[model samples]
Target: MNTLNNHENTNILDLPNEMLFAIMNKLSKINVLYSLVDVNRQFDQLIIDSFYIHDLDLTRKSLSGDISPIDKQTLDRIICGKILPRINDKVNKLTVEPLSIERIFHAVDYAQLYSLSLVNFSQEILLRHIIDNAVIHRLMTEQITCLNIQVSDKIRSDFSVKNHSNILSLILFIRENLNDLTFSHWFIGLGLTFFMYKLSSTSCVSSTLTKLSIFVNTFDDCLFLLDRRLESLSTLIINIVQIFDTSANIDNTKLPQLKCFSLASYQRTCSYDSRIVPLLRRMPNIEELTLFLSVIRMESTYIDGIHLHDEILIHVPRLDKLLFSITTILYNINAKIELPSNDDIQRGFIEKEIYQADSYVINDPSK
Candidate 1:
């Protein structure tokens, strides 16, 4: 009876605004708005507040770690029917998967929206909506400043590389104020599949984009993007499927405006010295640099701090932050050469003032 009385006397409305927000933060925006919006005048007013309505994620997450579009019933009754119609102007960012995208966009105009993420749309479906749908096309060209595209499994089954290329061209050229962009797809077992795009002389260029995160097929494709066409680009994050030595014919101008760079290659490469080192040498004004690489056949020498200091770090004088995860696998090991210990690797980094670096040695006797 005492416990029952305590529960009955406690009122959630007595909690402060911060406490209410904290509770809402633990719940989905959809659930918070749907459950609280019509409960009372106070709850309705709270749902309309900028803190609650500014960034809306309309995707449903499963316990198995899959993300999909919200169901039609919730979209109809709560989001489109009640919430969006009430606070569309306050929404600054919106994320939607394929199933809910058309319905939500057709329901109301997010006039204040600047960031949009379209997830799990196939190349065809994505382009059809952006190119054929007048409202979506207008939103992309006129309003959106940041866009993230995560293509669906349809991309894997579809063999039309032209459609993929067209998607890239449309995004880079048509968007008006787009400052940041991420365009990639995740493969089921193989990991990220880098799309191959060939830039052309007649292709339209974007003057507003400052940041880009993309996946490409080759190192030469990286060169094609840095060809002064994206004149305002100051930050680049790229993942290459394969890194190989490129011909010296491409433009090799210094990237003075590039302030940050991140390069990740899941595949092992032998061209770190030939291709990667020279590429890092181009970014003279880089304030931050990150490298994730798996290197093979390095003439039996690991890429220790000494090799990093001598080949790469010394060249970039302005760089203040360096984060790297590099693995070098040697072949044809000589029995006479004594392999460096984990302690020896630490000393190399300590001598260069990189005291936080860590190292370990893994030897596969069967290999």
Candidate 2:
């Protein structure tokens, strides 16, 4: 029998160099620099090698999209004081909010910057940076290849009336060469979803945007986008409130290049129909799929948890992996999942597994 007290305690700092570096990779670089830097010459040298200092998030953020106020003293020490000259050349991805966007540009020339993240920015700042000032335009067109943007104080109830032309223009601008894009907001309304699909209405489809994470408000929004500029989308993540029934058969449309899809539903109190069946029919080539959905088992009508796998396993032509996270409202119970094999499309063999949990990550064979 193994004893609980038999283990030895090892100090993190005393670990091997490789182990130390691995641990450092998991931690926030901002915290690492603030806490561990300048403590010793060895530490400084290790952190300065473009790995820890390459990606920087100058602004503080959280899931709610509220940005922490910038401290002038801290900014002075980080930018004008010591950081610019030390890691300017090494920095490749720099995230800045509207307040410090101009200041950071003036302080350093991140010649190597390939990715840029704009976080917690107001609509006014977005317009100024991209339109009035043209600072963001120049950086985006010339240097950046990947962009992640989170709008500020996203709508909780209402959106103030404003011209959305600038917002549309900025999104179109990024479509030029941006390979990966994440545009998210904390809004609980359908405005953001409408805006996302509106971008696809343009004459030109994005040939470069391969991966995207965005909100989908309705069945129309989903079908409209899947039929438009998102044709080249390979990896997609959808945050949808609900999928409704359509009078017309939607099987004609397809996400031809899509290989990986992740879906999450927000309307928790209501149980949905097997709407994903038609969706999988269109995505015939999907290799991996992940679902984060809430199951509402009301007393009047109870949906068998097996419904999750019943359709997908029988419909989708090819699927290699599946990840699921399901939440229940009335009662909590294990789900019986039916997973298809890697070659199930050809071999025609279906496998059944009883999974007892709220989440699971299942993989294929040939390991």
For model 2, residues 1-367, the per-residue Cα lDDT tens digits are: 2454434444555667777788888775656766676788778777787766787777765568556745676666755467667888998998887777877777767789989988777666676677655666777877787888776544543242232434644665554877777765544343453333344366325777788776656655555657656556898887876655656455567666999888887677343444555676677788888877776543322223344456565566687787766654443234434543324422322223424323332343321
Local accuracy of candidate 1 as per-residue lDDT tens digits, 284-342: 89999999999986446788988899888898999999999999887645553466788
Provide TM-scores for the models: 0.90, 0.73
Residue 21 error, candidate 1, Å: 2.2
Q: Which portions of model 2 show Cα errors greater than 4 Å? A: 1-28, 31-40, 61-66, 154-169, 188-200, 246-251, 269-274, 295-310, 326-367
What are the lDDT scores of the predictions, listed in order?
A: 0.82, 0.64
Question: After TM-score superposition, what is the CA distance of residue 60 in candidate 2 from its true location, in Å?
Answer: 3.2
TM-score of 2: 0.73
Instruction: Please report the candidate that would top lDDT against the real structure.
Output: 1
RMSD of each: 2.7, 8.7
